[model samples]
Target: MPYLFTCPHCQTRTEVEDEFSGQSGECVVCGRGITLPDFAPGASRPRNQAPGGSAGRRKRPAAWIAAAVVLLLIVGAGLIAIARVGGSAAQRVRQGRERMASIRNLEKIAAALNAYAADHGAYPAPAITDRRGKPLLSWRVLILPYLGEDELYDQFNLSAAWDSDKNQMQMYQTPAVFRHPNSQGWGSETAYHLVIGTGTLFPSTGPLGPKQVADGATKTLLVVEGRGASAWTEPIDIDAGATGGLINAASGVGLGGITDGGVCVVTVDGRGHFLSEATPSMTVNALITPRGGEPLPDDVLD
Candidate 1:
């Protein structure tokens, strides 16, 4: 059973359980402090009571209606909050998966490089050049067959420059291994690149054999993720002179942009590692050099 009550401050009506009769609580409608009437529902009115019974009944109905509206509002707001939080958590999970996929792509590329080295006694040159020494195709194109993309490799016109009309047509068929999982749009551009220079594995003049890498294979960086995307067949790559020593991706230092604030790198030994943005530039430079013989910090991999 419930008892009807009225908030004197705002004339707001409310219905309370019989147990709450004579107790005080704040009015749900007007937020005014109120004391419930000391009476139960359906009780006989006192002979001295002067109000119309119909008026009291109408007020009780109105109070219950207002409470229902407030409950709905609170429940709606709670549901919306849960939905927003769930959406954010799902987005984070997606980003994490993309990051791992990108890392796996680099690992596969590293394995291909090692396979190529085993057969040729040295890694592929950073780029293939014509008689005049102008670059024609990237090492990425050269390794297509090893990546199980033999059909794509056969479609390429290796004799022409990468941007040549015939070669350009193949851009639309970029391999999954060369494209970043989180790349903005579809294109033949690649996120992976070789850090070519005098002391690196891929020198300006030619590729270096494992024996030539005075630094241990595991200590030498063979390739890195670059900042800007390049055509998979393009001969361009990061020049150590132009990029300095920065290794973190998206730092505008020849590494691709990954939200994780780290860069994925493949060493000559076919191992992939993520280097933090906080890693010292000097330390990165030392790793890039195949034979600089610089001592690596014990925590370089940390």
Candidate 2:
């Protein structure tokens, strides 16, 4: 049965399930010690209980120690507060926050790209390569100045390959703006990427400007969010001909999105949108090409 439970310290009331009866833990609201009362729905409140509880509840930690579970509430920076009520609820809260965070990262990256284009007349080239046309540095390295990491950018040897001994340590200095909130222990890896191919905004031939996008700036795909093994400095991008904008493609390609059960994309107009897993392959492909002349699905924006 569900019954109203109140935290002794803060007097915050919640209608909780009977499964948590007799279980003790930190208060979900005020982060204080608490224990759930074991009772049925119609149980009468004792004399000093909530709604008319005594004033000394906050000062009485010893009264709760026998019942309060040994749990601590750690407030993560910029993350949503967790609920211990159920496993699925906690997971949902965590995933939603991660999706929002990844989208914000893409927005910052988009702003940097636009700033670069405003100054250079086009987005940075897909890669900085050697004289023999071997790829070295990613365009991510090219936009460091715009992302406010000028010192970290200067540390890189532009002429050397990303893995070259001269540029090795710089690979681990990925800026916070380029890193997804959930990426940990990956060591300077980034989930953000550019889609590159003949028909995409980043073509192997050259970087395309606003005037080159036939479908209009608001409709062109500029950057995508995906998990990859590549370091931020690696000159790797999703190949449109290879991946085709499908979320969580089957080939084990790194473009498998960062958010759980979701994909985030930033258009050439510097706006970010979250696409659900139910989004059709055709809808994703339509958004990938700037010159496809395909009309976007009406509900994609919804």
Candidate 3:
């Protein structure tokens, strides 16, 4: 079935097919990433969304900005080996290798997450808090030992806040695994962000175990490769409810993904995949929900 998709950036409309639903593609007019929409009958169409309310209707962000992503990328472990870069061929090759390395970084974090879950029976909450329930350190700090940074883990005063005098000094020593290769200019900061909010694997107040993810581990996104960098020790992450889009060039703060066309993501099963910025907002939402059990199309994750 084919339906019309409207680009929010350029306000241009085009007819597209359902096979591309939840995948990304570029707008012919302004050339921005656009996620395809599900034109199936009786499905929640974009019209039901709150007018000028992507924020008010978090669940239907795609509705507010219907048809705004671009083409799909390397789907699974194998990515499109080549991408065009403005610089010399060496730069392009270097970027390709760096993107691959960044995926490896995500895999390492996934391993650490598994190890932490294995030891504690659940993934660490977004942060570790004091007895009074005040946040003291981020999940990154809690997973230090799992990332083979045992010494760094031991030095932290778990009872103190992440920005405490003692902890602030140690922030510069963030493990290399926390940073992506292309995140060179960020300096000790990290680009990987965990998606947080209701229904997500990492809820605002939770320590969800593998058993809690009803969507199945392989279908759930564990970490998103963000384009912007933030302090590795800070507890900030993607707020799914607030961010309107995913894995695109026009994503606002906290919503942007890796450069080029694909957004690298790590699923709970410890596998890495490239999510196209054009992936339907609904499909992305379904994957973010831990136990929602939303039925996905065969091509959604394929």
* Residue range 130-177, candidate 3, lDDT tens digits: 788776777899899888899998998887877889888788887889
Candidate 1 lDDT by residue in tens digits, 16-88: 4444445555666566666666673445343334333333342343354445336545776898899999999
How many pairs of residues collide in each model?
A: 4, 1, 19
Better of 1 and 2 by TM-score: 1
lDDT of each: 0.75, 0.74, 0.72
- Worst window of 10 by summed lDDT in candidate 1: 50-59
Best by TM-score: 1
Shift in Å, residue 141, candidate 3: 0.6
Per-model TM-score, in order, reads: 0.72, 0.70, 0.67
- For residues 1-302, write the lDDT of model 2, one tens digit per residue: 34566668877555544445566667655778666666654464444343432234333333343233223222322233333445678788898888788878888899999999989898899899889999999999999999898999889899999999999888887788788888877487888899888777887788887667787677677888876878889998888777755687666563555676767878888888887756777777777777889887555655
Any idea what lDDT model 1 has?
A: 0.75
Q: How close is candidate 2 to the true structure, as a TM-score?
A: 0.70
Candidate 2 wrong stretches, greater than 4 Å: 1-85
Cα lDDT for residue 216, model 3? 84
